[model samples]
Structures are given as structure tokens and as C-alpha cells.
Target: MEEVYEFLKNAKTWYLATVDEEGNPQVRPFGAQNIFEGKLYIQTGLKKKVAKQMLSHPRIAITGMYQGKWIRLNADAIYDARIEAQQSMLDANPGLKHMYQAGDGNTAVFYLKNAVAEICSFTEAPEIIRF
Candidate 1:
């Protein structure tokens, strides 16, 4: 879990994939990430299409490249309605405060559950991490 978090945090920008109602895949670049209470959390606006897609389909994939290695993660995105979760994310990413506030109703935070991440590089065998 720590390795996965480090990879993502260092990557700065990771892509999140979710399935829409039509069953098509939607991919978007995301930069907000944090770990709270041993859970990896991501932030987005509740009004965004990505949030809607995630709500309808909790299963998702995320990938990011850092240095010469990349990480692919599959997990269930469980929405956390608690203000503390939202606030924690906002605190981690202070820039987000300009666009969202805790309990603002538009802020949405989700903790990844049952996550399996593979860190791969052409020069080495893949390293797997599960949390």
C-alpha cells in the first residue's frame, strides 16, 4: 500500500478509468491523491461525470507512469460521505480549496478498496502490491 501510494504521489498525474452507463470506458487525468486512516483516497467533484460514472460502477482502474516504471491499479471506489474524509483530502491538496470545500455538497472523496497494483518496468519484473 505504501509503495502504491508513493508511486502515485510521485507520478503527480495519473489516469482514472471508469465505466459509463452505456458501458463505455472513460479515462481522465487526475492529480489529487491522499491516504487517510490507512485508506487511499481520491478527490473529485460530485457533479462531475467521472463521479457519476464511479457511483454507477464502483469498479475502476488507474494507471500512472513515473521514471521508467508504471503502475496499474484495480479497485473498488467506495465513496466516503464523511466530512473528515473530504476535509482530509482538501488539506492534503490545498489547491483544491479554491474549487471545493469540505461539506460543500459538491466535494466528493472515495477510498479505494481491495486494491491490487502492479508496478512494472521493462528492465525488471513487476512488483505487486495489494491493500
Candidate 2:
């Protein structure tokens, strides 16, 4: 869990690769994830195309690098908008305070599917590692 937070915090930007209903890949860069109690929190516009994509195919991939060659992870994204959507985002980034108003309009969250973190590195061999 601590490792998860560290990786997410260090990531300047993450590539969210999702597949459309037609199985076409749509990759985009986004930065709005917060780590809470060993969980990763991500938010975005509900009207956005990614949101639509999630509805069709909830599976996703999130990746980042750590030590130039130590591939940080390949996460299984689980789109979750219910259960702590608003508070979790604010707690994670805190910048959302300025983005929010008297009413929380941008209140949506995505949970990592299966939510497994693997340390991907090709130092010597091919071993599937999970952190």
C-alpha cells in the first residue's frame, strides 16, 4: 500500500489506455489520482469520452516508470464512481478544493480493476512480479 502511494505520487502523468466498444484502443494522458489507505483514486469529467469508454469496457491499463528502466506498473483499471467519489479526490489532491463549489459538480471516481501493481523490469529475466 505504501508502495502504491509512492508510485502514484511520483507519476507526473499516466497513460490511460482503454478500448472502445469496437475494440479500438484509445490512449490518453491524465493526472488526477489520489491514494487513500492503499487504494488509488482517479477522477475526470463524466461527459468525457473516457467515461463513456469505461461504461462499455470497464477494463483498462495504467502504467508509469520509476527508475528510468524499472517499469513501475501495469494496473487493471476498474471504473468506480460510487463510494467515496468526492471526498476521496479532495483528500488525495486537495487542489480540487478550488475546483469545487458549494455543490460538488465534479464528483466521479474510478477504481483500478483487480487493482494489482506489478514491478516491471527486465534486469535479467522475465518474471511476473507484483508489488
Best by lDDT: 1
Models 1 onward score TM values of 0.99, 0.73
Mind giving the per-residue lDDT tens digits that candidate 1 earns over 44-67? 999999999999999999999999
Q: Which stretch of 10 consecutive residues in model 2 shows the poorest summed lDDT? A: 68-77
lDDT over C-alpha atoms for residue 79 of model 1 = 97
Q: What is the lDDT of residue 27 in candidate 1?
A: 99
Q: Any idea what lDDT model 2 has?
A: 0.63
- lDDT for each residue of candidate 2 in 22-103, tens digit (9 for 90 to 100): 8999988866777654566677666678877876787777766656533334545555545565576766677766765223
RMSD of each: 0.5, 3.2
Steric collisions counted per model: 0, 4
TM-score of 1: 0.99
